[model samples]
Target: MRFVPRPALAAIAALLLLASGCDLLSAEAEVYDSPLSADDRRAPGPSYLQMPVRQQGGAVLHTPSGTRVVRGAYDWWTRDGDLVTAAAGGLLLYGADGQDGRVKDRGLNPDQTGSTGEAISALHYSDRFRIDVFSPDLADRRTIVVPASAFDTDQASGSGAELQLHGDPYTLDGVTWVEWGVNSEDDTLTDHGLFRIEGDQIDGVLRNEPIVRLYPAYDGSALMLLRQDNGEDEDCGGCVVEQDLVELDPETGEVAAEYGMPPGYDRDWRVDAVDKVGDTVAVRFRVYDGEGRDATAQWQLWTYDGEWAEREELAGVRVWFQDGGRLVERPTDPAGSPSTSAGAYPATLTWVPGETGDLSDGEADGEVDGEVLFEPSGATCRLGRGEEFCPQLSTTGSLLPRE
Candidate 1:
């Protein structure tokens, strides 16, 4: 039997179709590259904090390991309402039963009081950051104080270089999305440190930890944990994350296989947070220029090769280098897409603005001098010149999404 590399075969088929010179996609085009204006930029979030939440007034700290309430007058209320107090197994408790009917026990506050429009919102509850629910009132539905914490400092201040945690994800072009971490490692209000817990066993190099780190790789699963890192030094530089492309056995939290992406790409691309199809992951990118004469759009896609060990192995070569490439699409339903066997692959045919080729009549307004192909190394007519996987001479229709 003749064996051919699946990825190589796919790349070749993609080459033939893409090199045919078709119209490009735009942000608003069918291909859909996310449209980003000059105003869309973000900054890195606060490095870390020791404690982001403070206990509210008249509050008392009590651990449930010491309580044993079995029915009778148990602390009970609906998920969408204020907490109610009830005398139970040797203690006074305040909490609510979720819509699923699970009783959530919160410690009691001797002086808890409130007025109109002042209760905690169940929808706003986040396990990642600390929330101090003080003086909650059921009758008034409002409280004296309800402070929530998110790992962001200046909610209104930021530049385009760093990746701030909250607010307007669309404005930040290259920024990846992350969520707060929550688990048994006890990222308590006062305990700030970096540690790892495998199953029930916690171990790893230690370091002073930050207040909060975004870890969206967790999503919803039993392998949930915000792996808080040293955030500054080499070994601990990683942020609080649950998992990257490296899959973990849901029930066991054991090491599974790591998915493949194009090489040289960092975990910063934010792929695990998007939708997936079994082993395949699809991406949504902002295509900037579209097809046809009236074209004014961009579309993008990043597909993950499930069979490979690391995505970085396929990193496209940097012909001089500029910003970077994108991991844009994830395939859904293996049977729905074409075979990854010989003669079939998923790739795009694009018209890159920065790396345009074949400019003979002394360059356009912004076009550079003596450049057939413009890369970070300047202009060139050489075979492998720019960041583009192909050339930019489209004499046909728009480039459609394909295998």
Candidate 2:
């Protein structure tokens, strides 16, 4: 081998050691001051919590100026500012203001359940049937067992056998009630009746009628929307003849209040949904064309506050209520741009408790004015210079790109 220059070899070896030393120092720095926290470090609190209760159709809870808290997925009931909800596993007690939330899950097997000011009631199915009543905190109070044959099963003219229980149980005063229907096998409600349960006793059929739907009033009354069978129309083959909305007294089983369709609408118009707050009732309906087909584009929303009725025709829009019986409307077309036309997806009206700086007078109505809150989808957004804006955050908590 030819002799190599000592100085050149030494220089090359020095360069290699320098490069390896730099890499070691860089790695040491990274390990010593990493951005990640230790595993046992305390975690930060959440910025906000998602509400647990899902609104049923247009039904919403009017909270009393605070964050609302609830538990489980269940049917909800409200009376005099108190909230009650039940599930197959348990029952929850809370306040309208989201205070004093309590849950009890022991000894509850509710197939159908309801709550009143006094107690919570549930119907459990075993070899037979049993009704269990519990305190608001779910303390066991009483249980009643009844025979399955006690319910009426009158079949429709051409339909097969009748199904036992058609709907969830409801409560009034201290009694629990459930609806029994026939023709359930065909998924049609032909005939129906009500049965009452009080303490350890079961009462016979209290009332029987062709009720299409039933809703519980805030004052322990039953609102029954009935369809009258006048046979099929000869001229219009599949048209409804008449429909009635009647309020029945829970004790006497008599009509307490009755509502008729507005002046122009006939029986062909059908109710789509019903929502109530305090003494006010909101009814949403759809009109039918002359050919007996549904006119989906034509929607009418009506509100009755025990004094007079107000009606509004809405197309491709949704409406809901605020805390103080206020009605909010929003367009539902996705083609329309957000923050300029209809609000963003899942837009809803929310009541802001405090003052919004944009208002000329610094007063709060517990209502949303877009400047401070959004509506219809309930997503919180900001309004500025005649435009609505929603906060968009990036995965790393930075503001997303915008025009």
Candidate 3:
């Protein structure tokens, strides 16, 4: 992405913010300090603290041993063996002694976060949109600024016009990319694009696409999910629009693969998440069975290999990502799982890296042997037992109960 001079960009951003009636910007950026207190030590409880049930927006970082949960603005917690530590806003660092600590806050808060390898990039919005790249140690590396016009928000409605960055930024093959859009409640139309960032310059690979989503592939490529306009449907009473998942090469911006929803289910299914493990790609979809007043839901996992034009759906299982391009799966109970009833799961799951070997090879044939390293639990609960090929985790109530 190419950026104008900072001085000019700042002026443009201020004008745009004023036009939109957003007064949240300060004359100067506010600094944040670490909120950790003396009493903030490891407490006796679940290894990891459960984030507030409602604060569901955040990012998950895969660690060597377990997963790190970054919740809300700055709260973060990570699991180490049988212990979990909570810290306030700052960088997260793992020590050589198997411990974690938070660096003093640098006063930087971002609207969107993305990661690639060990590098994390934060996108902060203000008068001028800025993206700050950081090292794994939280050291600032480079900053890129773009004029507000680049985002192009429409002001049709009286509500403030603003730019929105959708999903996380992705870094791969020495390049970083992010998806951004302009949304106005009054206008039904929205503009979006996937832009490639090179230093201060950004180039749009897919421009002005409607409702686009980006996911990084295991081999430095990206999967672009575009919600297609099928025009108005007078025949169906209530139908959900489907999205097309296209795999594009990051370096060349060429479509490497593409997949669409199956014929009969296109009207009532939506893509939940796209994940890659080794050479296999899994796309999760939520299918609804009826119209608005009586709809029922269930989750489906679809696996695709690069060469195979067709995809296979893994029935009745929920999958999560592991550190080394591996995926873990567990049975989903239709009667009790919230994901099957409400279209979303409350709690997120990340695998404990190095606890199990790669099951990708057998994953294609639907036969694999692996162990479940993490368990879902309340304040006090017993650990579950292992099954023939799949291990189990005990819980007081279902971690993701039906709504």
Pairing residues by index, what is the TM-score of model 3? Answer: 0.59
Candidate numbers, best TM-score first, in rank order: 3, 2, 1
What's the number of clashes in each of the models? 47, 10, 4
TM-score per candidate: 0.22, 0.52, 0.59
Any idea what lDDT model 2 has?
Answer: 0.43
Model 2, 155-187: lDDT tens digits are 644565534554556656666767665544453
Candidate 2 lands at a TM-score of 0.52
Report how far off residue 364 is in candidate 1 (Å).
25
- C-alpha lDDT of candidate 1 relative to the true structure: 0.23
* Rank ordering of all candidates by lDDT, starting from the highest: 3, 2, 1
Q: Is candidate 1 or candidate 3 better by TM-score?
A: 3
What digit string (tens of lDDT, one per residue) describes model 1 on residues 326-363? 11121121222112221122222212223222223221
Model 1 residue 178 CA deviation in Å:
12
Question: Candidate 1 vs candidate 2: which has greater lDDT?
Answer: 2
Q: Candidate 3 on 242-334: residue-level lDDT in tens?
A: 455555655544444344444344546666666454345556666667666466556666555432222333343454432223333433344
After aligning candidate 3 to the native by TM-score, how far in Å is the CA of 73 from where it should be? 5.0
Every model: Cα RMSD to truth: 24.0, 31.0, 15.3
The number of clashing residue pairs in model 1 is: 47
Q: Provide the overall lDDT of each model, using Cα atoms, as 2-decimal numbers.
A: 0.23, 0.43, 0.44
Predicted structure with the largest TM-score when compared to the true one: 3
